[model samples]
Structures are given as C-alpha cells and as structure tokens.
Target: MYASFFGLSQDPFSIAPDPRYLFMSERHREALAHLLYGLGGGGGFVLLTGEIGTGKTTVCRCFLEQIPADCNVAYIFNPKLTVGELLQSVCDEFGIPHGHNGPGEETAKDCIDPLNAFLLRTHAAGQHNVLIIDEAQNLSADVLEQLRLLTNLETNERKLLQIILIGQPELRTLLARPELEQLAQRVIARFHLDALSLAETEHYIAHRLAIGGRHGALPFDRAALQLVHRMTHGVPRRINLLCGRALLGAYATGQSVVDRKIVAKAGTEVFGDLPAARSAGHPKAVAAGLGLVAGVALLAGLGWAMGVKLPWTGASPTAASSAAGPHIAAARPAASQASAALAATATAAATDHFADLFTTLPRAEDAAWRALAADWKATPDAAADPCEALPAQGLQCFRSTRTSLALIRQLDRPGLLTLTDAQGRPAYALLRGLDARNATLLVNGQPRAVPLATLALYWRGEYATLWRTPPLDDRLKGEKARAAATAQWVSQQLATLPGVATPASGAAAGDSPRERIYRFQLAQGLVPDGQAGPITLMLLNRATGVAEPQLQK
Candidate 1:
C-alpha cells in the first residue's frame, strides 16, 4: 500500500538475500579472505565459524564466485546425514553415480573409489577439488571422520581434495573435543566471522541503498541508523529485518522522511513496548478537537452559501438540495481528475519500477569484473598488454592460466589490501602499501601516485581513481583530454532516454499528490518527506529523462 507513496521500486529492507542488496562489510571481507586462503592453500582443512546472522553464507557465496573452473567444488548444505548418506550426497554433488547398497562399508567404498579416481585425475591435471560444508556443526563425528578419510587420497606433494567447514560458533566447541583432536589439528587456516561495527553498519545501509538505485541519503536518518545498530548489534540479518519494517511503517503513515519518530514508531509496532516516558501522551484528543472546529465551520459556511435555513424540527428537502448543489458538481470533476491522474501515474510508475527490478546487479557474480578492474588499475607497469596485466591485477587475466581472483581493498587504510585467486591463494601482497602517506602503484607500465581523495573514494566503493603522482595536466593533455570530453558527451547522450515512471502507492483518502510523492520518495530510498529534495531529484532524473531544474546551477 505504501510502496507507490514512497516511490520505491521494491522493498529495500527485505530479509531475503537479494544479491542486489548484499552489502559487504570489512569483517565480511576478512572472512572471505580467510576462506579464500583456506581454499587456495590446496591441502588440509579450512574452518570458518561465525555467530548466526553474521553473513557466513554470504561470504561462502562470494567465495564460490571466484572458484576456478578446473577445481571441482561440492557444496554440502545439509549436515544431518549419517556417514553412508553423507558419502552418497558427496557423490551426487560430484556427479559420481553409484547405487545404494545394503551395507555402510560397501557404500563408502563405492563412493570413495570414484571420488579418489576423480581426485587423482584432477591432481594429474594440476587442478584441485574442494568440498564446502555449511552448518557443519551438525555433522556427526563419524561423518566428519569420513570426510577426513577423503583427504587421505592426496599425493605426496599436497592433498588432492580440500575440505572447508563452515558453521556457527558451536562448531568450534564441537571440534574442541579430545576425540575430534585429529580433525582439529588438520585445520591449517581458520577464521571467525564477526558482525559489523557501528560505522560499518551505517556503510552497509548506504551500500544497499545505492545498489537499489538510490543516489543520495536515504529514508534512514543518522539517529535511526544508530538505533538500528544498537538493536541489531550490526548483524546483517537483524539490520535488514528492522530496516525493512521501518520502511513499511514510514510508507503506511504517508511519511516520506523516516526520522527517529518514524523509526521509534516502527520499533514499537514491530518489537513492541515503548518506555512510559517515550510513550507519554496520545494525540487523539487534539486531533478530535481540531476536527470538531473544522466540521462546525464547514457546516456554517455551507448554510450561508446555499441560503439554507435549518429548522429546529428537521432539514427541508429544498434546503438540502440547495446545500448539496455545489458539492455534487464539485465532487464530479475532482473525482474524475483524481482517478485519471492516479491511473496515469500508476501506469507510468509500474513501467519504470519493473525496469529497476530487472536491471539489479547480481551479487557475487560481479566479483570478477570488480576484481579485474581493480587489478588492472593498480598495476600500471603491467599495462603493456592490458589483457595480460588484468589477471595479475586480481582478475582472470587469461583463459590458459585457469586462475580466478578475488581482491578486497580497505578504504580507511589504503595500505591494507588482500588479493586471492581461484585456488584461494593470495596473489598480491599490498598490506604495507596502504600504510604509506603517498603510495605509488605501477599498472600497465604507467606509474601513478595515489591521492588521499582517490583512496577515500575507493574505500567508499567507488570504482575509478584519481592519480596523484603523474599530474593530471600531463596525462590528460591533447587527445586524452578530447577523449575524456567525448566520454562526458556520451553520458549526455545516454541521459536523453525517455523518463521512467515513478513507483506509486495506494493512497489514503486524505492524501494529497505531494503526500503520495513523499511516500514514493521514501520507498525509492529517498528521504520520506513529500518534498523533492536534491537526492530525490537525482534519482528521478536518472530514472526518468526529465532533468530536474537546478536552482543553484
């Protein structure tokens, strides 16, 4: 009902893992790095543990994006199976067909033979195999031992198959048992994923909003974000639930701007029970008093305008007709215009809304593109062959290498960067470079000094960079400058497309068009108030062809 009122293409705070809405926090990056390390390490077990709702699955999904084609990966999500069932499941995952026998020993041997043979073949081809077990805490000791046995099929150089155990914190406790000591000892690299910090929480919200087509500050006020952080403790799942509810609340009440008041109201409605001090008084009495005065004034005005006199006994038909005359005619045109405008608006909004929905970025799949771009930009010296330099920069540079890369750079500290490839190996080490006050990177044989502003932008998830070492004047002179100018011209060309219709909401009886617009703004991830501010204007301009007139410009 409130969606059209807020102008949102879809619900922004949905709890479902919409790849488009995935916000990668620093902690998440670290977790992914550790997983990549384990996968790339090529032997032994890699363990990942985290509290519930910390986005462990998301990290795993992100890791899956960079896995090499040569490397066979089996992701076993169900851990409740017995040893025989587990072996059978693994076989199924690897597409190794085997009949279900009567005995456990036969089942194990049947599955193991094909798996070992596959591993041997993969090893001969210089490829690795990985098995990712999610919710691994539930795996019984027997099942885990069966998994350990699969690692026994390794060659003298390194294990043919790698096992990754992902589970809640309880998995650590389970592994701590003396009986499981052998399995625990085999874990070469382990990382515990944690929730985001308060600052990261704020960034997470903004990141999701931006991905959802928001170009400016969204419906969430700073205080509201703080409250959400406090309540959710930076857990992505919890934050999503709370934010989603808050947006719904803001939309329902025709509130475009989601301030603390709206958030508080949403919190109470969703979570229940505000403190006595906060819940102080009701506004119903004041509203009733205002309504009474307005009603009396309306009646008096009608009586005078229609020259109708109300008798002490009853209202005469003649008097009633005189009073209703202007109202009936006034209502007809107003109602018709309102209906026509609403239909037009809804039809327009629905078209643009669907476009936004379909155009969303797929989470994890784009990791390669992002990684390749970053690697290319960072390695100017390797630029002699941009294609070749691409992979070294953290991308799959060549099809021949059979390598995949995933790299994450920290914004707060430029020197703190981690790059990992398909086998989960660290391809580049730049931990020290980010610490320097003025850092220089060689990309495609071109040396460029990195500016603080450029670093800041990258940290904020912006793709491009502004080079500091070689002055801008030197690089952009003549043809380069003309190319840059032409790029701007292309942007103008793209901007000329037809405007998209804004999303609409089911309006309340008393709602004005501006009120509906405000709701639409909130839904679209803009501040909820009905006014079209700069942020809303930008989104509108981007979605639609109509350029909002800039008063300042």
Candidate 2:
C-alpha cells in the first residue's frame, strides 16, 4: 500500500522474504558466496549463523536456487524433535520409507538405517544428497548427535550425506559447546551474516525502492532514513517495519515526504522508549530536568560504565569506553599543564629504552595494596578496599592526580598508578621507587626497574597515596572508637568548607571524603593529587578554619 501510494509497482519495504526485494550488500554476497562454496565440496557440515533478521534464510534460499540440478535437498525448517523423531523426520523429508515396526519398537537407529541405505543408493546413482537443518539451535544435544552420526553414511571418496546447519547466533554458540566437539570438528566451513553499515543501509533502501519501480527521491527524507538506521540498527525486518509505518504516517498526515519526527513517532510504536533513542534524542535532558537526582544517577551510571564494582552496590562490572571514567567538572589547568611537562621531561630523561623485564602480576589491585603494606609497615588485605582498610591500621588512602615523579618521590611513599594497556585495559602498577630516569614498580607483586618514560607511556596521570592518620588518643583501644572520633572532626571541618555539601544527620562531612579532600587541596592551590599529605592536610585545616588540626602527622 505504501509502495503504491509512492507510485511504486510493489511494496518494496515489505517484511516478507521475497527474493525480488533481496538487496545483496557486500556482506550478504560474501556470506552467500561462502555458503555456496561449501556446498560444492565433499560432504562436511557447513554452518551459517547471524543475529536475528539479518537475512540468513534469504541467503540460504538464494543459494539453494543456484545449487546444481543433480543435488538432492532434505531441508528441515523446524528441528524441535527428539533423537528418534529427528532421524525419522530426516528420512521422511528425504522420501525414505521407515519400517512399520511395533509401537515403541522403532528406535533412532531404525530411522538411520533406512536413511543410510538411501544415501548409499543415491551415491551409487551419481547424485549428491544434502541435509539442511534450519533453526538448528533448537536441536537438543542428543538430537544433534543423531545428525552427526548420520554423516557416517559415506562412500569411498566423500561423505554420502552432506550436512548444513543454519540458525541464529545461538546456533554458533550451540555448536561451540564442549559436548559437541565431535560435530564442531566436522564443520568444513562457517559464515556469519551481519547487519549492513550506514552506507550499505542507504543503498539497501534505494535498491528496494528502485526494485519497486520508484527510483527517484524516496518518500523517506535524509533525516528520516538516518533515524530508521538508528532505530533498526540496519536490521532488514526492523527497517521494513519502521519504513512501512512511517510511510503510512506520512500518507495519513497528507505529507509528501517522511521526516525524522515521523520516524521517531513510528519507532515509539515499533520499539517503546528505546534507551539509545532517548540518549540520542536528548543528550542532557535527564541531567537538566531532574537536577540533583540526575547527578546521582549520572554518578552511579558512570561508576557502572567504568567497570568499577562498588562493594556496597553488589552490581556486576560492565564494560565501557576506554576513555570512560568519573567526570570532574572543576577546572584544574595547572594540574593538567604540570602533568604534561612532567610526561615530556620523563620521556626526555631516558635516552634509550630499558630492557623490558616486567612481568604482569596475577592480581593488579592486590599487588598495589601489597606494595603499600610494605611502605606503611601494616598488614592489609589484598582484596580489602584501601580507603576502608587502611583506616584500621591508623592510616588512610588518598587519591591524587599528579604527573611529576619528583613530587611523588618528595612524598617518599608507594602509590598505585592507574594506567591503560595497549589494548586499553585498565592496569595498575605500584610506584615503589622513583629515580631520576628509572622507577621501581611492583606490577602485581613482580619487581622491575623500568624507565620513567616506559611508565609515562601508559600512566593515566592518576595514582593513590597512603597516609598515616595520627592516633586520636593514647588509650583509644577500639578501632571503631578512633575512626568515629576522626570521622566526626573531619566531617565537621569538611562541612565548614565553602561549596562542600553537608552530609545527612549523623553522616560523615562529605559523601565521598576523597572527593572533598581533592576539592580542598585544589582550593588551597595544592596539586589535587588526591593524596593526603602533611601539606594538603595543613592547607585543608587552614581553609576549614577549624581549631587544632585533627589529622596529625
């Protein structure tokens, strides 16, 4: 109807699997070509898989049409059958008569014997037999094994029965199971159909319109076409659904061309409240509309995005962009420039690359904590949170952003360096010793003296430094008591600082004490290194305008 309204001879965007509208993109051609090549060779399992609605079935149909006239096909569309039933179905599809054995007497082996006889008889007659199982992912392990064993019916040179498996992505995973190792090894060739790219998608739509006899300007405008791609992710079925609906929408509105707004409204009907659509439609709507609540969600989302598992949240770590991390909106140009200069100086100091003797440690975070324990003369759990665990040893973990090795050495303490590997995996290295040109690092408990340039190459200019908090009193027996007294004073001082949000009643001064400490350090013209040192503490005390510094040396 949309095609006719647009002066097309046929509904080009119909969701039905019509070979007339089968636009073969490069990927589709390759997938089809690969499958066809497998069919020509001696009998072995040929596998084809793809995500939902990527035209796997269409490609298979096209290939089947092009197959040699002498080839015999036993195509199974629905494979949800028991082992005996599956074998019987295969024989039935191949026109092989099964023995009329008594009830409950005909076994899977009984069906296989006749199929094997048929395959052997066909091979002698100079004809090829191919068994194609569609939706093979639904086939149970035992049923699949029955299929594999059927391949044993072979002649002197090649398999008498050629097998092909086609399904969704689940089919690929199903074949990869350890129990299917035998079947997997018999696979001669495999190909996965993928969705079209943006350019290919544009071509696909145009080609279909041309096929429908409407070659000129399409009803979908440029923005409308782009939105269709975003909404459908180049999935053919989804594209059809959206484009068809958008055309109807345009016709109903008495509009000549479909626009992005129409496509968006169509998408709402096709896919309700898609997350990607929301993010793309309004980048800052959530943050701006909800205000403070949005900030909390943003922070939580950031944490999850960074693959940082919060001990309290019990949420699994999620993969994110390599550059993804917590966003800091505050200005820190001095820190940025200083880090750049340090990186340059560090690179220039090493005239030659040192021998790479570093071995990646088994546990990166653990290695950093181990190095800190060595520096502070305290036993720390490898898995414990440094921020929480260090306090029990009368110490605290402070994070700082710094680039200068000299400043890090001036503090004369081991710290954890956050860096990215070549592949962009987050890595940790403990800065144990800092020399002029080389630095000793404990990478997961392995020791090495690497060039500062080597460290600078991967360092993210972020590190964690440990600080020993002076005991509150001589007779503070309980760790909780000491921590309470320290938290009370720190919270009070943090509350007094300008722009620092006060915590709830009976809560600590700042929600994230480390963040508060960083703000304080920056306000005092400190490095904002996120480390608590004598100088940062002194500056923080002065800015808090509090009596007697509670954080002692």
Candidate 3:
C-alpha cells in the first residue's frame, strides 16, 4: 500500500530472502569469503552462524549462485531430522536413488549402499559433492555424530562430501560440547555474522528501496534512519519490519516522507512498548540504570552485567565493522574456548578505540612497566595492588593507551594490555615481544606465541602498555635524539632494582653504547634488532624514573 503512495514498484522492506534485495555489508562480505574459501579448500565442514536475521540464508543463496560448475550441492534447509531421515533427505536433494532393493524393499542399509556408490561415482567423474545443512543446531547429538561419520567416507586425497552448517550462535555452543569435539575439529572455517552498522544500515535501506524501484530521493529522512537503527539495532530483519510499518504509519497519517516520529510511533506496534525507547530522552535514568547494572555485574563477578550489550568504546566499536579494519573481520576461528576467552579480554582492553576520545586514565596501561616487572623475579602480588605492591618490591607501574600499530611500535618496549573476559572482568596480558610476523603475549604468565594476523582479529585499536619511567611529558613523546643519556641512566638503575640482570662488562665499550642499549632492549621486551628511535628513549626515560611515578587509575 505504501509502495504505490511512494511511487515504488514493490515493497522494499519485506523480510524475505530475496537475492535482488541483498545488501552485502562488509561483515557479510567477509562471511561469504569464508564460505567460498571452504569450497576451494581440501574439503571439510564450513560453519556460518549468527544471531537470528543476520542474513545467513541470503549469504548461502548467494554462495549457491556462485558455486563451481564441477560441484554438486545438496542444500538442506531444515535439519530437525532423525539420522535416517537426514540421510534420506540428502539422497533426495542429490536425486540419488537410494534405499531401494532388488526385492522392492527399502532399508537403512539400502540407503547407505547406494549413497556411497553415488559419492564414489561423483568422485570418479572428477566432481565435488557438498552438503549444506541449515538450522543445524536443532540436529540431535546422535544425528550430528552420524553426519561426522558420513564425512569419514573419503578418498586418499579428500573426503567424498564437503558440508556447510549454518545456524544461530547456539550452534557454536552446541558444537563446543565435549561430545562433539571431533565434529568441531572438522570445521575448517567459521564466521559469526554481526548486525549492520549505522552507516551500513543507511546503505541497506537505500539499496532495498532502489531495488524496489525507487528512482528518486529516499522516502525516509535522516532522523528516520537514525531512529530505525536505534530501534532495530541495525538488525536486517528488524530493520525491514520496522521500516515497513513506519512506511505504513506515514501513509496512514497522510505523510509522504517517513520521519523520526513515524518510526517512533510504529515501533510501539512492531516491538511493543518498552522502557529502552525512553533511553534517548532520559539519559540520566539510563545512567542510573547502568550504574545499578554495573554494581550488579561487579558483585556477580561478571563484567557484561554492566549493560545488556557491551558499550562501543573508542577502540572496541562493534568489532568487525569497517572501523575495526578489514584484517580484523575474518575472525580467526578460536583454537579453543581458552583462546576465545583471551580474544574477548583483548577487546575489552582496547580503551582507545574511539576515533577522537582517549582513555581518561593513561598510566593504567603501560606495557613497558609490565615488561620490566616481568623481567624482575618478583611474583606479581595477588593480595596487594600491583601498583602498590610493585613499588614495595622497588618498582613502579605506569600505563598508557596506544591507538594504532605505529604508535604502539613507537613506544618500542614491553607493555601490559588489559583483557576482559566474557563476564566483563578485566584481565591483563603482558605483550612481551612482537615482530613483523608474530607477537609474544604473556597470558596468565604463560607465553603464547600468536600470529600477527590472528592477534589483529581481537586488537580493537586500544591496549594498555606499561612504562617504568616517571609520567611522560607531552613535549617529550617523540623525543628520539637523547638515547645516550637515557640509556646510561637505565644502565645505572638496573643494578639497584632487585633481581634485575646487570649488563655484562664492556657492554657499553662501543662508541654509541649500542650493545648496552641492546641488552636493555632485550631485558624490556623490545625487538632487539638494535635501532634506537623515540620508542627506545621514551621507555628508557620511564625505566630510570625520569618521569614522575603514577598509579593505575
């Protein structure tokens, strides 16, 4: 009804999996990349999951349209089937004549025999057979195990069948069950689809309207778009539902342009009355609510309890958006739950993720101080605050937030990064060392060597790095020219600090004090390649207490 009034040929915001209406946001495009990569791989399961309405079906349909000609795909939309029924459905989708006997009887054995034969023939013909199961979270454990057995049917080079399992986030949890460890191992690629961002949401609405034959300007105004994003949380299906209703409301009210009020009024009908909608108008109330939540979260030994959803910090804006960098989008499938938890910790520590905003507490994240502490033989205090306890141990902790790779590399010293677990309890990691190819992260005092690319997946542009120097003066930030003085100062301090290894005699015999500085760099977790720039001096200043000692905020 609204379409005709707005001069559109069709309904633009219909929540149907229409290929023509598909809007591939950056996150969705990365999702497609993972699926397509699976098809080109040595044949294993490809997993795609998201919260409901993240366009898994749209991506899958898109994948199907682009499937290779030599590949035969059997797409299973509903996976709530018994093991026998699932096998039969696969045979039906593939047009494989199975479960028939010479006596004109059908049995499970009959089904298996013909299916295996069909797979062998397909492989002989130099073709690939892929089985894609959607809503796979509903599959029974025994049935999932059966699917795993099916994957075992293989040739010398690869399996006879490649599978793609698509479902909601629960599927990831389901697979994590100890019983499904084998099946989980077979998932060579996995991606979690996130909601659209505010910018992408605008593009999505426009793309759908254009596809629906809107030739001129957009019907919904800017305010309308913003409200729609807030109300729908940039979820595609929710956006569609709300937009469609908003258009209807505008048409009913005899207004041509959909505005903020139209969306606000329509939201009542679509999602029902809620306290959250008032959040925009009453920030103080929301803040109070947030405080209550934070108290509860902290008491419950949880961090996310601070809010229903994690706040988009300067560095941790809805991770995987265009803001988080393209390399961060292809989420490295976590090696295990422990690794996954560590990634979460990394994100929460990215306090400087916001473009213009900086972390209020600068001295809480210095990786240099953490590194110096690590080199010292003292066990980090559990009973005493690290800042206070370390000082008693003849050391001081200082922190700073860095926003980019260059800024971090500029500091050129060991730094402590804050990590938050799923519950939101913040943890800390010492970035012991890094190079072009890898990073040495000290998680819980255990050294974890992670690929540079893998670490980027969780690095949200903010990490707490430590410095042992007195507080940094803004003018001295990039002061690279004074290396000799700073190195000499640190060399003398090393002997006084307890358990610190003093440099070998003649270490400073060189004209430039190069070996002495290199020894100091190695002690402080700087990549000991022996080029002293501003980072070396800044760290050196921190080590000799040239800056004022400050406690963590």
Candidate 1: list runs displaced more than 4 Å.
Answer: 100-106, 268-553
How many angstroms is residue 115 displaced in model 1 relative to the true structure, after the best TM-score fit? Answer: 1.4
lDDT to native, each model: 0.54, 0.64, 0.63
Candidate 3 residue runs with Cα over 4 Å from true position: 100-107, 279-553
lDDT for 363 in candidate 1 is 31
lDDT tens digits by residue: candidate 1, 1-553: 2333344556666778777766666566566656665655547789899989899988888789877688789889999998888888888898877764674456567888888887888789877788999999999998988887787887886788889999999999999999888888788767788888876787677656545544323556566777777767788887777677666544332234455554554555455544521432244432332333234335644654687542211222223223445442232244433443454355346434423322232233233333334532454343244444443333222121211011112211112122322244332212223322223433333333443222222233222211111112334559768556534433443334322122223222453435444433433433244554433444444444442211110
Cα-based RMSD of candidate 2: 26.9
Cα TM-score per model: 0.53, 0.50, 0.51
What does candidate 3's lDDT look like per residue over 69-187, in tens digits? 99999989888888888889989999988756478546667667778888999999999989999998898999899888888888887789899999999999999999999999888
> Which regions of candidate 2 deviate over 4 angstroms?
101-104, 279-553
lDDT of 2 by residue, 1-553 (tens): 3344466787777888888776766566566656665654467788889888888888888778877888888899988988877888788888999875777778766887788888888888888888888888898999888778887877787888888899999988888899999999888767788897776676577667666776234556567778888889998888888777766554333234566665776676567667644644563542232332234335544656797543323211111211223231121134433443454344335423322323353336666666666666778766776667767777667676744443464345667777765567666677667654466776545566765435544564687776656447757779799767766666567778776544323333436765566555534434344455665654454465533312111
Single out the weakest 10-residue window by summed lDDT for candidate 2: 314-323
Full-model lDDT, candidate 1: 0.54
Ranking by TM-score: 1, 3, 2
